[model samples]
Target: MNHKLLPLKVFLLLALLSLSQMFCGINIQTENPTADPGFMATGIAATLTARAVSITPTVTTEQATQTATQQPTETESQQPVQTEPVIPEAASISVSLDTNCREGPSGDYQKLGYLLPGQTAALIGRNSTSTWWYIENPKKPGQYCWVWGEYATLHGDISAVPLTTPPPPPIPIAG
Candidate 1:
């Protein structure tokens, strides 16, 4: 191992390790498993096996007795429960020009209906690139369609909009 090449060798090793981990879906657990950080990846292939433990009857009895004896205090019962405020996601867009709404994010999809200029529609979601917005079909109620984002003026935060799968085309009924 040349001293001058040590840094390069270390960098190459790290790069190879990262690439291998990414391809193999192997994640190294750096923190305690008990503290769930919400963002941690699930369905991990690795497993942690714990040694067997024996508990006496007296300890179990005492624990149960303690739990049974505990009761909610008057103050605790009177206090109002705190809840997170639900912030409604903005999912509405105004059509800048009269554009045909399609079943999917692309023009190749079947045209569901037309969104008139200056008309507003509830945005359901967007494609991967956010180039198109999937909105509720104004002409046909209960149905949803996609419109090009370039032709529409979004009123709210487009990032808040969810990604949704486009509905399947309606099968034609043969007369």
Candidate 2:
């Protein structure tokens, strides 16, 4: 064919091949234009090698002796991976309305502070009637007091709350 048109056809073929990334050999440029075609493809010819190789590999078949290969006594073993135990969260309580936190479960006890509508406290203990909840004081940090559960929202494991005995009633004093 025409040598002048060959370069343009090759370039168009390369462009089409490059647009479709599937063809791997499109961009490969031969380094030695003077190298022999047959040996150059094998990479050894790229060196313009003369009298490059004379060695040839030959194979022979033979029966192996029983002692030639030994079987392993033990195999690679994997130990069990240890995981951390998941602990359940403690129960909590929230007041629906502003409620009074008292020293004891009853109304007679001295009022400590008020647990507001939006505040939450830990439901530490519960009375036998379940009417009162012992909680971390919402107003006073690091301290605890009892609040009536009538307007309270109980969350988490409520059964996990331990039973507690409330203090005795306050004695009335004459003024």
Candidate 3:
């Protein structure tokens, strides 16, 4: 073979080999001059890693147990939550303008004192008719009065007791 044609023949053989390798599923990834190959590969790897992290819930039982234990300790160290005392509200008291408070339990009971619209009273009993509440006017000392339930709303102080019974009162001294 001629020397000039020998080089041409070798070049043709190499090209054919490259073409056959491509047809046989040989992947030869060549980096483009415009972009860094490493940067592109790293970005693709990072994206795949992020996708894997999202797809899988990586928490183990030990991790969950550790979190559970740590949380209650933090919660216990937190301040005790203050809650309003729950009261079984039964009755309420209100005032009528220029209202009269009686001296005794029944009407024809003398008016011992009077109350104004802003006065406060404590409900003590129910009236005979059940339509009115028997109230002790807190403002008028030692006075029991009556007011209609239709006009009065309920008022009572609610106190929180610890969830246990108190100890019994001490026995009376012997005579």
- Count of steric clashes across candidates, in order: 0, 0, 4
How well does each candidate superpose onto the true structure, as a TM-score? Answer: 0.45, 0.58, 0.33
Q: For model 3, which pairs clash?
A: 91-154, 92-153, 92-154, 92-155
* Cα error, candidate 1, residue 8 (Å): 59
> What lDDT is reached at residue 9 by model 3?
58
Residue 10 accuracy (lDDT) in model 2? 68
Model 3 off-target regions past 4 Å? 1-85, 148-151, 155-175
Candidate 3 has a TM-score of 0.33
**lDDT of candidate 2 at residue 99, scale 0 to 100:** 94
How high is the CA lDDT of each candidate model?
0.66, 0.72, 0.52
Better of 1 and 3 by lDDT: 1
- Which of candidates 2 and 3 reaches a greater lDDT? 2
Candidate 2: worst 10 consecutive residues by lDDT? 66-75
Spell out the clash pairs found in candidate 1. Answer: none
Q: 1 or 2, which is superior by TM-score?
A: 2
lDDT of 1 by residue, 8-109 (tens): 456556656885776587444443335333322221211111111212233545444532222322221234445566454466776545899888877778
Model 3, residue 31: C-alpha shift (Å): 62
Tens digits of lDDT, candidate 2, 22-52: 3443453434434444443544443333233
Report the number of backbone clashes for model 2.
Answer: 0
